[model samples]
Target: MARYDVPAENHDRVLELLRQLAEASRAEPGNLAFDIFEDIDDPTRIVLLERYVSRDAFAAHRETDHFRDLVLGQIVPLLTSRTVEQLDAEDQ
Candidate 1:
């Protein structure tokens, strides 16, 4: 699984975008899970957790038009700062 640490000020707008993004991912072949979490300490901070069946599935997801649009178009412009972490059970 991977976690995207995203920060944005446009609360309602960002949530709207997230709703769309979540809906879009649900139809993808490799998407095992897709979920979003809002940080308790900071309202602006959002975490996106993505899970896939395999590396190939992850690659396939990146090629999808919705993914492209979300990364290149919507997220980049909306986020103030973002960081992605590949989470592992051992890390905890």
Candidate 2:
């Protein structure tokens, strides 16, 4: 999961970039899911839920062109803050 606090002035652009990122990420062979959500109380606050086949797949995702360009190059600079967390599902 990832959370981003975007500046009010850059909200629209950030959202656009995120949409593009989601589309590209979901197309990756290693990606299982990619979802985006906005805070109702704070539109500038955004959350991303990403699921990959493995940790290696997640790492590869960060290295993808869309991730580097849209996320690192574009969206990151527009945010005031960002946080990421990694979680593993327990075996049933």
Candidate 3:
């Protein structure tokens, strides 16, 4: 899971960028899921539930142009704070 606190003043722009990022990530090979959600009480609080088939897949995702350029380069500047966690089930 990934959570982000983005600028409330630029809410729409931030949301748009996140949506674009989600779309691109979902289309990546080995991505099992990429879902986005927002806090009803606080629009600035965003959550992304991302899943990949394996650790290598996640690593490949981090190396992608869109992740580097759009997410790290573009979105990080718009965020006030962010947290990310990588998880896997025992079955994996």
For TM-score, the strongest prediction is 2
Candidates sorted on lDDT, descending: 2, 3, 1
| Tens-digit per-residue lDDT, 1-92, candidate 1 | 43334555576677787778888987898887888888798777777888777778877887989878976678757777667665432424
Give the whole-model CA lDDT for all candidates, comma-separated: 0.73, 0.93, 0.89
TM-score for each prediction?
A: 0.79, 0.94, 0.91
lDDT of 2 by residue, 1-92 (tens): 99999989999999888899999999999999999999999998999999999999999999999999999899988999999999885658
Alpha-carbon error at 83 in model 2, in Å? 0.5
Superposed on all Cα atoms, model 3 deviates from the true structure by an RMSD in Å of 2.0
Model 1 — TM-score against the truth? 0.79
- After superposing candidate 3, which stretches have Cα over 4 Å from the reference? 90-92
Of 2 and 3, the candidate ahead on TM-score is 2
lDDT score, candidate 3: 0.89
Residue lDDT tens for model 3, 1-92: 88999878877887888789889999999898889899999998999899999989999999999999888988888899999998884563
How many residue pairs clash per model? 0, 0, 0
Per-model root-mean-square deviation over C-alphas: 2.8, 1.5, 2.0
Error of 1 at 64 (Å): 0.9
How many clashes in candidate 2?
A: 0
